[model samples]
Target chain A: MNILIIGAAGMIGSKLTNRLIADGNLGGKAIDKVILVDVVEPTAPADAPFATETMAADLSSPGVAATLVEKRADVIFHLAAIVSGEAEADFEKGYRINLDGTRFLFDAIQAADGYVPRVVFTSSIAVFGAPFPDAIPDEFHHTPLTSYGTQKAIGELILSDYTRRGFMDGIGIRLPTICVRPGKPNKAASGFFSSIIREPLAGQEVVLPVSEDVRHWHASPRSAINFLIHAATIDGEKVGTRRNLTMPGLSVTVGEQIEALRRVAGDNVVARIRREPDPVIMKIVEGWPRNFAPVRAPALGFRSETDFEQIIRAHIEDELGGTFVA
Target chain B: MNILIIGAAGMIGSKLTNRLIADGNLGGKAIDKVILVDVVEPTAPADAPFATETMAADLSSPGVAATLVEKRADVIFHLAAIVSGEAEADFEKGYRINLDGTRFLFDAIQAADGYVPRVVFTSSIAVFGAPFPDAIPDEFHHTPLTSYGTQKAIGELILSDYTRRGFMDGIGIRLPTICVRPGKPNKAASGFFSSIIREPLAGQEVVLPVSEDVRHWHASPRSAINFLIHAATIDGEKVGTRRNLTMPGLSVTVGEQIEALRRVAGDNVVARIRREPDPVIMKIVEGWPRNFAPVRAPALGFRSETDFEQIIRAHIEDELGGTFVA
Candidate 1:
């Protein structure tokens, strides 16, 4: 089986790539070839069992998607997008890279008529805006508040339409905020969700931007990668017309996350978290959905952590090699 | 105030144009100019109190929208789109005119460097797909079953995004089916909705293609025209970020429609209706919305007929000079 991973240079992309290589197969079929691509050149896996190619290409630019589609990878994972904070900051760049870029890829696939492939697109919970219900259902309408959310919602719409038209077999999964990220803090509005747990566990001080009561949906990086794999291998017929799905997630407040952190590590680790209210990020995050009643994903066999503790545990095991600063 | 109506030759567009001329004002402001456009050359009103210009322009064509936007009409009504059946029949034409054409107009306005006009976009209930509730709420997610619906939904998304970016002051109203339509039977799947009432009242035979229980939401052409004017005049501030809204309409079944027709045009006129079930058209109409809880539009002061009789009455008064063939 041949596989193609777009946006293969990102953390989740790299993790997914390594997982596929380690397994040496996908959906019980042996992985014979893999192509990794992003705006920046992706690194080829070392000592690989299959022929792997990595290249840098801007999807928004014409002809780039055509080249990728011409390769005719059996299963395509389109995870490339401008991040939320950056997309909102730069409107033109956001629309070009996220909206137009994704369109280019879909159109290129259509251009190669009769070469239908399984396309797994990464959408986000940002598609849901504020004034949300306590637990948003699977069929909640997308009223995006930010440019990033708008672009992602549009991506979902386009992918679903293309799939319906038989241009491709597509599934768009709206991911929850990933917690305990294994890296330095970024400028994302959701960064605090990860940083509070990740930094403290690593014996470093972290700032809490929002209040303790501020809640949001989350999953471990492991679940996210698993969602991608599951999406690629599932029976597309079962998804029916509603291809874009709100993924299952653990909805918890900052207090619960701290409690989970305190339980996992010692009190000393919990003390590393410093509360510093950021009204800007708080206001932005306030409009985000705190939870979802994602019946579709769960019924489709995609699972995630039930509690915040398991999420932090998964992060420790996956990102920290089963160890932390303690 | 200057006004621009794209697709001015269409039924709703023509009604809106004549209404604007009759009133000679919009939101209490004197109407001085009206630019009407469609795929075919629109007919300019003779001896109008305002300067009326009529022209034909394919908006999807490059530079067409730019010219219209450069003129900087203070209130622009974008009502151009292929019907649902036509869009389903012709995919490229649907996307070209509905999606790309709408985007062109928004982009053109943006390109003019901050010429933000009040853009009243006419959306439709077709945006909602099948397996719907008895009464679709304002928050219902759009999973359009047809290409025309998909294009309209996409147009709503684009206009909302553009509005958010300050490119234009926009409001999209999802109009219900206009019942008691004044014209010969067209090939539209929903044409029977109007034809059943119109043809019978005009001493012509009309086929009832579906069952008596098939329910749908509807309004009069006058109500549709009022919707456009209200969308133009309503304070955009009230709409906030979610600019697209489902318009109010009378929710009645085909049986109720026949009852209203019998009441209006007498039993003799209603006898002209012939029952002939069409599986194809029935399948299409089956996916339509039965009713709507358009909380937003009502809150914004947009109103429609409370009962189907009022709808039929409006058609007779407006189209038949206050009398029917009976």
Candidate 2:
């Protein structure tokens, strides 16, 4: 089996690549070749059993998707997108890469003759907007508040329609926020969700931008890779025409996340967290979905951490090599 | 007030054009100019109280929308789209016209300097698909089964996003199937809904493609025109960020519709209805929405026929000079 990974240089993309290489096979079929692509050149691991190629290409360019589609890989993981902040800040670039880029890729696949690949697209919970129910149901309508969310929602609609038309077998996974993000803290609105846990565990101080009661949906990086693999291998027939599925996630507040970190490590780590509320991020977070009663994904065998403690533990084991600053 | 009507030659568009001329004003403002555009040159009514201009333009072509947006009409009614049958049959033509055409228009509006018009976009109930609730609620998810529906749903997403970004003050009215369509019977799957009532009143036999119990939502052509005017004039601030709304429509089964016809035009007209079920049309109709519990439009002062009798009466009064064949 051959595999193609678009946006293969991002956080989840690199981890998914490593996981696939370590397994050496997907769905009991040996992976013979893999192509990794992104706006910036992605690295090809030296120890992979299969032939690996990595290249940099802007997907929104006119002929880029056509060339990529010509490869005719057995499976395609389309995880490429401009992040939420960047997309909102630069409207034209957002639509070009997120909307037009994805359309070009889908159209290229449709234009190819008798080549149908299992396409796993990464959508986001941002598709849902504010005034949400206590637990947003499986069939809640999309009323996106941000340009990024609007683009993602449009992508989901296109994915379903293309799949229904028999151009490709597609599955859209609407992922939640990734918690305990294994990197240096940044200034993203959502960065506090991860930094509060990551920095404190590393014996460093991290500022909390939102209040303790501010809640959001989250999953670990390991679960994200697993979700992609499961999506790549799941039976399309079972998904029916509604190809997009909101992945299961743990919904918790900042206080709960810090408590989970404290339980996992020690009080010293918990003390590293400083409560410094920023009203701007708080207002932004208010429009986000805090919980979801996702029925379809779990029923389809997609899994995730059941509690906040497990999310932090997964981050520690995977990102810290089973150790932390303590 | 200056107005622009895309697809001005269409049934609803023509009716809306005449209505605007008859009223001589909108939202208490005196009408000054009206621009009508379509793929075919639309007829300009010489007796209008405003300066009328008609032109032929394919909106999907690059730079066409830019020229139109330069006019900056106070209220723009975007009523153009490839019908469901044509859109489904020609996939490329459908996306090009329905999706790209709408996007170009919105982009052009955004590109303009401080030009924010009240854009009344005519969406359709086709945005919703089957396996629906008895009365699909306001928050029901969009799972359009056809490419045409997908394109319209995408248009709605763009309309809402653009409006929220202050590019345009837009309202998307999801109109139900128009009953008693004032034209000769066509082979379109949904045509039978109107033909069953229209043909009989015109002293001609008509085919009933589905069973008597098959139910669907509908509004008269007059209602559609009124809905457009209301949408163009209503308070956008009251709509919040959810700019798209399901318009109020009467939900009636075929048997009920025939009964209403009997009440209006007597048995002579109802007897002209022949029951010859077409399984192909039946299968197609099965995926359509049977009813809707539209709350937003009604709350916003948009109105429609409360019963099938009212729908048939409106057709008789408007299209048949207040008298049927009987």
Candidate 3:
């Protein structure tokens, strides 16, 4: 089966691509060819045996999605999207790429004629807004507080509609914040979660935007990749008409995360974190949902990292070669 | 204050226009002028007090909304949309008119310098899908089962974003299905609710699509107009950042509606209703939400007709001079 991974250069996208190549197949379906498309060319696996093609192009452009899906991929992992900060900052760019780009891809698939690839779309927990109960239930309404969340919510609706129309087999997996995300700090409002741990572990100081009590939902990068794989292989019968599923994740406060980091690393590592409260970031964080019940995803076989420790360990293993430099 | 009403020729649109004209002001602010727009020329009021102009053009067209809003209307009532049945039958048309038309209006409003029109967008209860509990709360996520619902849901998101960015002061009022809609039969899936009562009272035969057990949310056309008016005039402070509010309505079953019809027009009129179970229609009906718990809208002073009987009476009073020809 031929496979395609859009936004293959991003964290989750790159990880999932490597896993797919490492396994050489998805749930026994042998991948003969893999197409990796992103805004920037993704680094190819050094020992990849499969026929891998890396293409750099803006997917939002007309005919780009159709051109990418021309060979009729058996599976398409659509993990590409502008992050929360960028989306919030550049509204037109965000909608063009996130909303219009997703729609274009769905339309492209429909136009492909009888080629209904298993589309595993990566949505975010940002889809849920605040004033939520302690743990947001699976059946909660999507009242996104941010433009990014709204875009993802809209994308979910479109995916469901296109799937219902039998244009394609689509599944939207709403992922939690990936904790201890490997690589340098980024512009995401949630970036502090990782920066506190990642930067501190490298003996660098990182600012804490909000209070330690500020809580959020989280999963490791590995769990996110696992979710995509599971979404790709899951029986479409079980999902029924509802194509979007909120994946399971650990709900922990910033204090808990800091404590976990202290336990994993040491008091010295924890001391590298600086407390700097910003009211703007606090207001945004306060409006965000802290956790989700995600009953459906687990019942449907999707899983998350066991604990924050496992999340940290996965980051160390994947990014630091099982060792964290002090 | 200059006010603009899109879809001014439609049932709710025309009534809202007349109501605004009669009231002469909204929420204590006096109206200075009114711009009525529709696909066809609107029926001008016989004796107009305020300056009123009717322009016939498709709002979905490029530059139409910008041209309409060029003078900078103080308030914009975007009530135009393709009905559910039409939208479902023609997906492209649905997205084109509902989605594109809304975006154009929002963009037009934003483009006008020093123009911050209070946009009262008419959304529908169709935004909520089935598997609904006995009463859907304000927090219920939008899981629109039909293309029409999807379009409305998307529109709500866009309205919220545009509002958040201070592009325009917008509010999305998700109206319940208008019962006893005073008019000839139209192509809407929910039209049967009104047709069963309206046609029978006019001494015409009407078919019941589903069983009496089929329950759904409803409000009279008067109530729908009331919602639009309230949404337009209500203080933005009361709404805060949550721009969309589910308008209150009565949760009535098909049996209750028929019972109300019988009570109002006697069994002779009810006898004119024929039972014809349509699985296709039933399936569509099944996916619709039966009730909503619109706590916010009411707190902010939006009101709906108390009962189905009153709703029927309202139809008679407003449309037929409180007398039936039968």
Candidate 4:
């Protein structure tokens, strides 16, 4: 009935908030209240069908997580994290926010009396490193090459353990890179994957840092939201002890992505993606997961766009209001 | 070269200390000093060839890790952890000792300027849970079923990350169940596995909690010490970024272990094991790993006993002065 969305100011979190309000209910239950919290106060929607409260707080700070959960929301979506590049740059800050913050939230829930809410954690495909199989299997070991990936993997482990101990019903979804992300490009190493698509569609030239043959896994913002919702409502018992899962997505090379863009919005839009090699970005991208053969998340009813063309089209439909610059 | 051994009061730690003392050198360098630390003061060996310091300290305590690394030991063997049964019973204490203590030690190393010690971390097979393939592969995912397993898995992740970041030259060895552990019976769930072989040879009755058909992985204590020493001195560059490795071990069933005991110590000793089922222990043991195809450790010069009979004989020769009650 009640929901709490941490990191509700971020891209997927903001979109998910709008979608949940639009739907007016979750899992056949009418929404009673929605509380949005982020480091920066999230803009609350006007005249929503349900009660709304917005606040700014850092979950890593002492006593913040404990105070926030006093409302006893039926579901919690934890999406707050420093981006991969920033985490690598600031080691102490990364561990503080990503690792300690997540643990604080989980421990807070455990310390609470008779409260077992469904928790949806946003993990990443970064949990898997390079030198992958053709498609990384569900049983593939986590050997994260970056600090951000390591922190996320730790979060997944803690989530599973806490769930197994019956402290909370938690599901960690290892999201694929969200392609065609709607917003200005940020400093995330994976930002170029989305910006190359988003910026070009908006009639702006964007630099393609890596080579054309470089492959990566991707889903759209809409699909990522779908994953979070599904994870929140999924049956914990059926999911078993392995609560963390790699969400499905389209695996395509940069060249394939360009072709998909060409097919969706013509060669004019595709041509806007200029080639400019940045070796720093290239080296960082080298260690990322290219693809995954995730068996568990798909079986648990999580879905994503089938192809890169579908992903580009979803961005146009949802963020571009049924039209691109073309 | 100086060496620091944490948890030096424990079975493997003490044995490893004695072995190091006996050799008087590591990697062809003569031993300059040896520091042994634990929760309680470890018994110092009389007339050691090198300088030895034995002290009581809890690594999880504030400032303890920082102070311990002040000497900047060339090789640090971090073997400190609460046993599985105790960790399961006291969750907070388990996490404090196993997880936070390890992180503290690592972070302390990172904080020390120009001090990058070779760290040998003792992990466990508990990192891998049940529902395993016939032989768990090198890339098998960690899905620990207990609090202790969860803590150990976290340690392995941190070790690999720290090593990758260049803060320390670290190697984590996921040890198999130490068969024929030389000590009085303790409360660990896995204690029975050792007790069955240990107590029978001493003319004492020991309970066989699990069914004879239950198979598990094992290695002798001598092999464990050898793995530690090898890990401490091995080439870090050759180990690469995947610093944590599952040590190779023999896989055998309880029935097979009993047969090995009969062959090694005769029927009188084998008859000393009483058939008394423990539902709790059985449930706990059911989630442990039975076999592994550990490709990396063996290739990197890590080894263990080849057969269960060899494990029993190791106990007899090492702990029983080359004779048993039989």
Itemize residue pairs with steric clashes in candidate 1: none
Candidate 1: residue B173 Cα off by (Å): 0.4
Model 2: colliding residue pairs: none
Candidate 1 residue lDDT tens string, A145-165? 888888888888878888888
DockQ of each: 0.70, 0.93, 0.72, 0.91
Lowest summed lDDT window (length 10), candidate 1 chain A: A317-326
True contacts kept of each: 0.49, 0.87, 0.69, 0.90
Show the lowest summed lDDT stretch of 10 residues, model 4 chain B.
Answer: B157-166
lDDT of 3 by residue, B217-284 (tens): 88988899888888888889879877889999999889999999888889889999999998888987
How does chain B of model 3 score on TM-score? 0.96
Quick one: best lDDT, which candidate?
2
Task: Report the lDDT tens digits of candidate 3 across residue range A181-251.
Answer: 88889777778989998998777899998999998989988898899999999999999888999999999
Judged by whole-model lDDT over C-alpha atoms, candidate 2 comes out at 0.93
For candidate 2, the per-residue lDDT at A21 reads 90
User: What is the docking quality class of candidate 3?
Assistant: medium
Candidates by lDDT, descending order: 2, 4, 1, 3
Using TM-score as the measure, name the better of candidate 3 and candidate 4: 4
**lDDT for model 4:** 0.91
- Give the candidates in order of TM-score, highest first: 2, 1, 4, 3
Tens-place lDDT digits, model 2, residues B44-122:
9988999999989989999999999988899999999999999999999999999999999999999999999999999
lDDT of 3 at A201: 79
Quote the lDDT for B232 in model 1. 94
Identify the superior model by DockQ, candidate 1 or candidate 4.
4
